[model samples]
Target: MKILLLLLTVSVVMAQAQAPHIDSSYSDGQIQAFLKDGFERNDRLLQAKAYYLLAAREQNGGINNEYTITYLQKSHELFAASRDAYHLHRAKLALALSYVDQKTFDQAFDLQREALTYFEQRNDLFMATHAAASLANTYKLMGNLPQERVYLERCETNNKLLKDNILSLAILNSKVVNFQRQRQYDQALSAAHQLLTIARASKKTNFEIAGLFFEGILHQFKGQYQTAIGKLFDCLSLISNPNLSPEAMQCYLHLSQCYEALHDYPHAYQYSQRYGQASHAILNNQRQTALQRQTLRFDAEGKRRQIANLEKEKREAEQTALWQRTITIGIGIAAFVLFCALFSVLYFHRQKTRSDQIIENQKEEIKQKEINELRQELTLQNVQAIVTGQETERERIAKDLHDSLGGMLSTVRLRFDALKTGQPTHAYEQALDMLDNTIREVRHIAHNLQPDALLQFGLTAAINDLVNRTHSPATPDINFQTYGQEFALTPTQSLTIFRIIQELLYNAIKHAKASEILVQLNWQTPSLMILVEDDGVGYDTTQIQTGMGTKNIQTRVAYLNAHLEVQSVPDEGTTVVVTVGV
Candidate 1:
């Protein structure tokens, strides 16, 4: 716990030292599309901005990986080439921050200083304040508190000129950490109070929670256990879902310590148990997420290889045809020129040319036929994959029932028989527990196969049921909205669409790590549009060809001749839109 608290303080300091940027209105895919258009139009400024947006998207994804640095570098070069000094310096500041994240302090320090000077000279306090904050963060990481404080002061001065509460909030957060690190509880407490006031005024729940937690820690350090407990409780209450929040865990941990310090063993034990449960839940979630990612990666690799093979074959065939046509055309032109002076030879050449044209038409038809056949083969394969996946799922459920439930029932029967012959106390209770677990497993399997609401009510009811079942404290909040009137569809069509939405929601919850999800359905005459959007960690669509869930969705979409579009930006989120003829 001592080590945990020490690490917590350092992490809090680092986290609060940097200013948080607003989420981008556009997704990564949308930006990439814009970038492609810009390149085609030879718009250097647009290209530079797009590159910078990509860099910011990468930063929002929580790391300074190679892609982030490369994008920023590209953006910087383009801005310089376009002679856009304002944006060029902005790019330099971003690059400096990226370097800081990479822990390349030397480069970060130099670039940050240069950008800060530029912004200050131009009287751009907004950018200048950010530049100062970043430099301070770098210094903080390098363990130079005095120098860190100096730049932090610089940030405060610029922020005063700008009068931005968001900027002030960031500065105070770092101040709390700095003061606490220096063992100055009074100053730290003051900063914490200021942070709490600004956060509450802005209605930023997360920052408010952070401020309360900081105050609790400061109070605890000053040996005011009762006061600390109150502050921690307030922090815990502000969290919408305690079980799903790391903040809740922090509060529980500190509350337990505060109680223990006061020799209140019962409350301490209670909070300690809650903390343990929260920690275990978090760990399980992390493990499950890691397993899902590994599975997706394996699936994506296989699909990519298959697609590559198909493309290679197509390219080879096209190349062969191109060479054959080129050679024939060259020979035909040469023969025509050589025979132009002789009447009889010219007449023979015209007849041969007519025959050659017929042969070319035949070859073109054959090529078209082959292309059609190839497309048909691809379609058949996708259908087969979907069917095979369904069969696999059925087999898995059958195995679960046969092995797990069957074994449990046999054990229960034996236990009952032994009980009749006189067994140990609580034998009946144990048998009941086993029976209860078996019942729950049976219901779970049945629900996966087909929901009762789907059969009894319809698509809307089933979807509502799904949202209710899938949304939990451990998962993101899912909001289902419908625009226009509901439309009728056959049972099979409804089930297909339901499955597609189900897979999308699963991806958002298990894979995307989304905080919130919105599933909207728009019903129109003879058509329906489905949109699923999530504020989660998005991916570069160009790099990822497909996944198992994506394949499933694609199969269904093809069946209905629907149009599907997916747009995503790293850290910004993902939006999936599907339009189908009802």
Candidate 2:
């Protein structure tokens, strides 16, 4: 994580030095259609964001505003369904802002309230403050200052709670603009100063530019020409900071107004020309990109449809040719009359050979059937051995509980009965202690005999218990990783793998004396792969004869029609790989 941050910082600095701009091309209608299909085909999150942001840009451009709201709403629902609360709030806020633009104040207010609830519930004050400010702005637009003031105070309070002065500046700037609309110069000037102070500390040059703009407006209102001009141009210089295009253009237009106010006719004319040209070029580039994107999308869709129709036509032509060939095949059959007689005799002879082979296969199958039955018997016996051991253990615990604990507890209960209620002795307490321990031991034994947790949990928990019981506190590291998906094998498959793993582990613990062992099982498409590897003094492959254990391993694989590979050296290590068809 630390290394990634350092690398990201270096990349950002280098990219900034290059001043590379991302002029993205996108079709309005075609992008909408593609994104709609993207959700319909497989409603994934990145696709939802893809459509939502596309619609947002369209709304921002004042094109297809209604449809953009619909897309944004749909994207918000998708994000909510995916449980991405952050993005869900973002999309809802965008939709609300769009509604505000369309003068649907009631709907915008409701959406913003909902968005605020999401942010507030998660204690995300940054987003919460934004939502609050948006609500306040809606109230102001409706000419309700009392409600607007309440929401504005809330926004500021939340911003303070978050200690985000940048958000504070943004909110105050919004309020100053509202005050300016009411011709409240004193209030506007105060708010704008607060905004400027916070904005300078923000370190975001773009935002500081906004702060300076508001300050310049305040100064121009007061007829302070020189100071405002210097401050405005200082803000303008930051316009080429490699992250300022839209703001830069806006700043230039506002600066022309400032120049016009000072009655500098020539300077005003120059500033106005620059503003018009820059705005025109930006809009022109946006339109051309949109056109190119639309053309490419239409051409691609047309080509796809044409290819599909051609394929259908080709298939129909092939079918027609096939019917014609069928008619010609009748004539060819008659022409080969002499060859048919020789082919029949050869075919009959081959059929006889096949019949013999089938008989041989049936005999071999019966032999394999008997071997399978024998293998099943051996596997059952192994299971029975473990079960028998558990039964013996249970009997021993039951005896101790009944003979030792039960007798001692009975004696303790008699001692308690003999004691007066007001004159209980320390001996009575000792007897109580022994009685409690006895009861606990009995319960422990019962729990060990029948581990209810095994049924409640799963094979993993069961293995964990077995591992804790058999191994010491500190032993060789055990690595167990399940790949793909977890699954319960059929009884037969489970038994085979379990017994194989047990035998391998037993060898590692008792004979091989290995320090480390690794067992892995991976479930892949239509197959499963099991691998067991150990770093130990492995046996020589040539020296390994078909012992009882070796036969058991090979036979188990054979029964499952699985391929098993064993690789080992005299001293290095050993690895067992098994692949079974699902």
Candidate 3:
């Protein structure tokens, strides 16, 4: 179970570490706007950069993969057209990587080699080292271990000269992969160990996990089934989300194989089943990605056709205008004047019609805007009313339970104690104990109905109390921390925040099955940030977006006009960050 749990998170780490760094300072809309601005200003360089940025963004998100490649190609063209050699080579490198991802090794190899030569010629070791590493990876994928080794050697030399730990790690990873492919188990194992040491020293858990995985593979290839199982399980133990990790799938498959070799049918079957599920999930993801790329391709093609048609129409209109001018030049002055007068009348008539249409459209738009605003206001009011009513009812119930039922239970316990003291009977003592339990249960219910600490102490104290109440040996340990000076909040805001945190905690404990949870509050000058994180079996955010819990949280978030970001990967855990204007 521990092995499987660790395997689950491997994807999360690998997914983070594997992606190229992308600038997210500007949004997709902003980038597109910049692209438009560049076109309008006849700035090819700006347009090229925008296209590259868009491609990088798409690559990072794994969206529109085919369109991303197209964007990179266009960016490369624009850079070359603008005589930007450096950017052109950079774009070529991006394009090559994209081709590698798509398994088009021929194109990838050519482009990568070109970019590599450019960087090497300039003695740009930083870029050259990465280019060599990428080329090696491409060769590795193509089953050309000799070529891969050649590039790996180059990468090693460059890294040695530069003394870059990151570059060294990349080189080591490449060597491990190449050695494994070459069936040099001893060399591969050594490289894996070195990789693991460097990864651990650098605190790169993802690389460490990768090294462990490679070690297990090497051991398995050497026919050390038990040793391989141990190493594979070690790899799995480090991962958080096995279902999403290809490494996890490999781990499961190898574990199954190892168990089968050991004649452990039950364990083998269990791992085989896990491997099947992981494979199915991965296949589905691949299919979805392919479909998205295909859709983007279709959309791009359609837009291209539309642009072509529009340009054709513009050209035809220009030709007609030229013909009209040439005919008018040959016509008499009276005929030309009469034609101009007729054209002016028709144009004015069309202009008046367009103006009327525009006026009506504007009026309709204003009406719709007003309706939307009114609807939103009503929704807010309704939510506020419902919450206010629920709190009021909760308060009433808590008061009744505490002051009425609680008092009665306590009184009964006292009377039973007094009677027991007089009689000194076992029956009376048992009744007294029962009364004590009843009294405690009533108080517990009352406390839950409406926490007095929240009403008296503020958000910080209330959260602490919640953490204390939620924590137990059977539940995930809750860690509560606050930073910055505390700020005051209205009763509603305080309650809403508390409820949001409470729901998050419940989800983490009950659904996530986490071992640990962290709740943080940071009160800044204008905004308060609340973060709830858990190291639990996470869920697919896309799949769970419309869940009731999510909807409820979103509603509360809307009420506060707050920004909420939820990042989760299967088996890795979930992190929810909410930023609210104070």
Best by lDDT: 3
By TM-score, the better pick of 1 and 2 is: 1
What is the lDDT, from 0 to 100, of the residue 340 in candidate 2? 84
Residues 1-582, model 3: lDDT tens digits: 112112211132111211212233455456656666566566778778878877776665556467779889989999999999988888887898789888999998888888889989998887787677778778777888999899889877877888866566667877887888788889889989999999899998888898899988788888899999999999999999989889999999999998998899999999999999999999999899789877766655664455345446656766888899888876877787898898998999999999999999999999999999999999999988877887899889999999998888778777766666568587777877777878887887788778889899999999999899778789978899999998889989998888889888887887998889999999997899999999999988778757677777888888888999999999899999999998
RMSD vs true structure, all candidates: 35.2, 21.1, 29.4
TM-score of 2: 0.37
lDDT of each: 0.78, 0.67, 0.81
Better of 2 and 3 by TM-score: 3
TM-score of each: 0.46, 0.37, 0.46
Candidate 1: clashing pairs of residues: 28-569
Query: Judged by lDDT relative to the true structure, which candidate is superior, 1 or 2?
Result: 1
lDDT of 1 by residue, 1-582 (tens): 111111112122211112222223455446655566556556677777877877675565444467678878988999899999988888887898788778899988888888889988998777777777777788888888778789878877877777767667778888888888888899999999999999999987777988999999899999999999999999988989888688898889999999999999999999999999999888888788768666655654463355345446646766887899999999998898777756677788888999999999999999999999999888877775775577468657756765677667767766776666565658766866777777666755657566668768888789888899888799998999988888788776787788889899998999888889999988887899999999999999889778889988998888777899999999899999999897
- The full ranking of all candidates by lDDT, starting with the best, is 3, 1, 2
